[model samples]
Target chain A: MLKNIQEWVMVFLIIGAIILIGNWVGYDILPTAAIPGILTLIAICLLGLIIHRLLPFKLPSIAYIGILGFVLTIPGVPGSTYIVQWTNEVTLLAITTPILAYAGISIGGSWADFAKLGWKTIVVGMCVLIGTFMGSAIIAEIVLRFQGII
Target chain B: MAQQLQRLWKDWRLHTLVLAIVLLTEMIGTHEVSIGPGLILLLPMLYAVIIGIALFFTPLVNEKQTKHAEQLVFLSVTLLIAKFGVQAGPALPKLIAAGPALLLQEFGNLGTIFLALPVAILLGLKRETIGMTHSIGREANIALISDKYGFASPEGRGVMAMYIFGTVFGAIFMGLISGFLSSVTPMHPLSFAMATGIGSGSMAAAGLGPLVAAFPDMSEEIIAFSGASNLASTVTGLYMSIFIALPLTEKMYGWFRGKKDKNPTKIPSRNQRRCYKLC
Candidate 1:
């Protein structure tokens, strides 16, 4: 019954797509918005199907990571000189992002595996981060020098 | 509780030390001004990549530990992006106006899941595992409620609702408090309130964006002052939600459970642990 419903939905969708395409063609709006939206939708569908096929089914952790990155970016708000404000933004990002990321990972994986990683993980993690930052600084300096922007 | 607190402290301590050292270096050092923003964004990404390299080198680095570090770095990158976008590009209103289209464009990603589920069902996937793997009903419920009840159901929606709620209440309360305090002090009530409210997340952004946009002529220090005040509120909201909300919700559940008549038939037969496990 559900399969039939699914087929019907797909058919309806195809019909709708044809109508939309026909209208766009009739209106000579082919190269403008319709093409991009349709193309983007097709790409997303293909990617989704490919991902479903390749991976053992799991939620996308990357999207949540992107969201975390989004939240962290909040503090970099321009033209603020308050030390407290700066720290607060950094602090919120520091604390909340990890919790959220962990929650996401746990949701995507086994809860049992997540619970085992203790405070030691965070310490080692920071050490790795320091190294990362140092390497980044060098690369950024080189890039800036090359671009003559620095 | 103690263990969790200790973990938070350890992580935060390291984060604080790094930020302090790096920020101080940037301020005190005679670094060229032109490459500042690029450098800022590059730092967190570099940190993530380097950490990835370190994980590869150290065979002893467990999977979870690597994930924990990655999460932190991810957060840092997120913070940088949001800040940079606001500073260099169009502000919040413009960004939000773009949000709905982005969401709509991504609807295929959502719809494809529904497609996979019924297929999996046809394949005679294990009932228990299938139940654990999909959350269409839960998602539908959340979407429905968010549209209807809006931000009232705390856990029903994710951070979006909380952001909206916090912004609304934070602005009203902070405005009043700042007004009262400013009467006796030199501080601008709006700025003070804004600074106090910023850390809580939504309110700080909404409040600060509008205030800054409104008073473009205001000194950076004044804006900073508002942001600074909001810092504490944001932190308090973050920490309190974890420590307070969880326990309070648990207690509320217990109280409701205790008050319930002993009607065994009324209890849900569906396994909640199994249900939530999928999400």
Candidate 2:
């Protein structure tokens, strides 16, 4: 993995470079690349599999999800009120529930594992999130109080 | 591949179980109430954050336990980004204005570093494991690779190619969706494009403006419909992408000639030390 880090870095750099060039070109080329990039990734991965003789009849579940996600993202009619409102509503739910759910479950599971450490992991993770926010708020309040900004 | 499948199965059960509980809670909690639209929409976003934390902390148990776990995490996070990116649409000016400060605050998450220092010592997950957790680039690299190649035989060149591919497509998909939605409604293509970039990455979302600009004009009201559709497509698209990747990868694996290792490699322990690249 360490040996490959440089390659990853180069990829990111290329991405950044592309962004810079796009900015100069001032075209919406950035988002347009999503389709090409996704297709390319799938193609390359498939190609790699083929080379390695690892291409199975059925694709991995993740690959399926990626395809589904791409399909779901297809553009609707250029202008439709119903589409906008619905997407807004859906976007809200999509953004919120899964992440919180993931956190809740992952944390909850960690808490289960935390038992082996006798509550320490739970305490720490909780504090890092909850505590940091609370601490920041409190400090903000204190500074506000001193400055009479509250 | 079976090892990844087994891990995914475990996560699915876990995810389902948790979501079920959340759904039940929402029903029971909201039954007596007629919530406002703002609050109603807020529920999922908040839920995502909560779940994201859960997923983040859910330990790997071992390195190869579920190769899919990492992908799921990425998908979950991507979803969160999409959700917030769209919702935050109304607040674009403010967020951009505060972008610098926000960036600083992001840096200040280094506070979590202190938390890690002590917890890692206490939990016995070596300093290295804890360190890796904090490193975004490392996490990205791991995520990009693991999604394609399992622990048995990670093809770095292959994974890199895919990451580049995924990033670009995700961006375009997001851009198109954003542009499409913005055409019909008051929503901005830039926001959607940015969200797409963030959700998928910049390379893909960067191309959205022209696609959006090219759409036929409808009366503003009709354009609103397009906006709604765009929003749905973007959000749903992100979710579907995640689901698609997992099953497709598994299917592809099955079709390929690799035999399932009866005794696959063990997952790396949380505290286990491993070299991480900073650059």
Candidate 3:
């Protein structure tokens, strides 16, 4: 267990370093704030982990982490200004880039599994996709029309 | 402990590789291509596809490495979800103020399962496959369905098919369709963004990506509303699937086939007991 914890520490250190690099590159793209943004991000991840452990429900850790981050940044919170400053829109983009890329790599790894499902799977997939898109859109349209938000 | 450490190291290396590839592609794409107005939203997804396809063909990584890479999905999802939540935080009051409309939008997001049920039945799918197809078919759905029915079952096969499809094409489709709808439709961007957050994180990103590009100023509010809506979809959608959607789909399948099995096969308690004992 001690060795396992040590390994996780090492892994987090590597992740932290990667986040620094990502933030640096992000600075080039949207040159606003820098280190503080990275700090905010790390804090968010840590908080998310803690909350996930504490929560009883089996929902993903992201849900709790997001709620915590959101609540922390609300208007009346003590350090709301600092939190807002650190989590700039561009910083969010920087954070998203790696996640999306990881998603791509993950999908690539599953290619063999995907291929095994065959052509009928594609047909079923299309039906689901089209159904989801249309269903969501129709609901959105009705709500928008009724509310006159458009 | 040592084994766990080894696994962590493997995952760390895999994450590093993905990060490097993302950065490299982002730099190249930013320099070489001006993506323009319409295509700007799909930039991340495009990069993801390019890198993903390249990784798929290269065979530089072994199967174990790829499996490790897949584990990083939780990290990626957590980060994105937190960011979305934080962004959406201040907008919470506003979102709540518009509660009923938003709820309707969420119902619409879940409307796909109902629409897909008849078609799935028509395709000659079994009860398990039909149920799997009608559900959202995310990782959780797969775990739940597979655990209850076993991975070799028809339900497992159905969920796997949708999972692969959603993983491969869901992002691109959501991105493009949301972009098109936002531009052409008379609906509010907030509603459209909320609608995009049906369940999957990547799918929400794909839908929100274009909306963000189209309305840069409202990006935070858009993220907030969409994130909240996505969370709602994830939590509520799961229960709906288990208690409502799957059962409804099963009945629909029976009705469509015109030969309803009065006595569905129930796995014997003795068989379950034996399986547990073996485990």
Candidate 4:
């Protein structure tokens, strides 16, 4: 478990550094300025992972990670001001850049696996992808209209 | 042992490539072009995916390194989850206010098999359609199908095909759709935002990039609502897949194929009713 945490810290720290650089180049948040926010984000992720490990029942740590971040930064929570302010300095798009890049790299050799899926699978996959988005969007639009929220 | 493992961190190839990709893409910035009523909002994240994929073909990348790159994705997205979660926090009240729409959105999620299953059948995909059409075929969907059917099952291949497609094209495709939808649809930014939370990390970020860009004023709400909806999707998706999505897809698969699903109850014993009251 300690080893696992150690590896995670390494990955998160690496990602945090990339996020800082991207923020600097794209949004001009400055690597120095964003450090505290980056640290806060990392801390929350670690905390969530720890909680997930300690839990008697299994739960997705992603949920814990998200919940901890949300609970800690909610309007009236202690330290909420600092947490919110610092994290806000980190650009959302800047964060996604490295994540997706890694995603792209991870599958470079695996294109063959995709090709193996063939045209039938490709068409079906597209149908699933578009269907999910449109199905949800259509439903949400209806609810929004009926609720007059639109 | 620790020392050797630590040396893996020195493998700067992974970090350097990702760093370069992020820096270059962010510099390119966001560009929105109107092709008729459809707006194509090109985002840096989109570029990052493309560049990363392109980088793979070059001598700089190899299969082993790229495989490890895949492992990092699950870890990396937590930071994104935290970021989105923070956005959802302050806007908790607004999310609750949109509660009914949020609730019904899960039904829309279950509705995907309805669209996908038919097409899979038309395309001559057999039992594999069950896994592919189920739940947009994210990692969890892969697990759910593999657990029940084993990874070698046709259903498993169905899920995996969609999963691979999602990994490669989910972000780009969703980005285009979201961007175009934002400009053309009369639905508010919030509706589009809710759709952005299509139950995955890259897709959520990529989907919302355009919505947030298109409706800058509603960016915060867009982020917040989607974050909450994503959480809902992640949580409910498992239960929905187990109870609703799988059964519905299996039932629909039989109906669509006309000759398949000889038993109707494949493995889960739906006739056992898996219920006391609902049946």
Best by TM-score: 4
For residues A84-120, write the lDDT of model 4, one tens digit per residue.
8888888787888888898888767667787776887
Off by over 4 Å in 4: B1-8, B259-279
What lDDT score goes with residue B222 in model 2?
21
Candidate 1 residue B72 C-alpha distance from true site, Å: 3.5
Candidate 2 Cα RMSD after full superposition onto the native fold (Å): 19.7
Question: What tens-digit string does per-residue lDDT give for candidate 2 at B19-108?
Answer: 453454333221111233211112222333344334444562223322333344444443322323223333334434433323222222
Candidate 4 interface RMSD after superposing interface residues: 1.9
Query: Candidate 1 on A2-90: residue-level lDDT in tens?
Result: 44334323422332243233323323344334433333322323333334345684433222222232343344544233322332222
Residue lDDT tens for model 3, A70-141: 888788889887777666634455555565666676677767777787666666676676566667667766
Write down the DockQ of candidate 4: 0.64
Candidate 4 chain A minimal-lDDT segment of 10 residues? A107-116
Q: What's the true lDDT of residue B25 in model 3? A: 53
Q: Give candidate 2 regions above 4 Å deviation.
A: A1-84, A91-95, A98-113, A118-127, A130-150, B1-22, B30-77, B113-279
Model 1, B140-256: lDDT tens digits are: 324433453343333343223222222223323322222233333343323232333323232233234323322346423333333333322322333333344334433433333
Residue B110 Cα positional deviation in candidate 1, in Å, after optimal superposition: 2.6
**lDDT, residue B3, candidate 3:** 82
Q: Across all candidates, what is each one's fraction of true contacts kept? A: 0.01, 0.14, 0.51, 0.68
Docking class of 4: medium
Tell me the spans in candidate 1 whose CA falls farther than 4 Å from its real position. Answer: A1-150, B1-81, B84-100, B103-109, B128-279
- Which is superior by lDDT, 1 or 2? 2
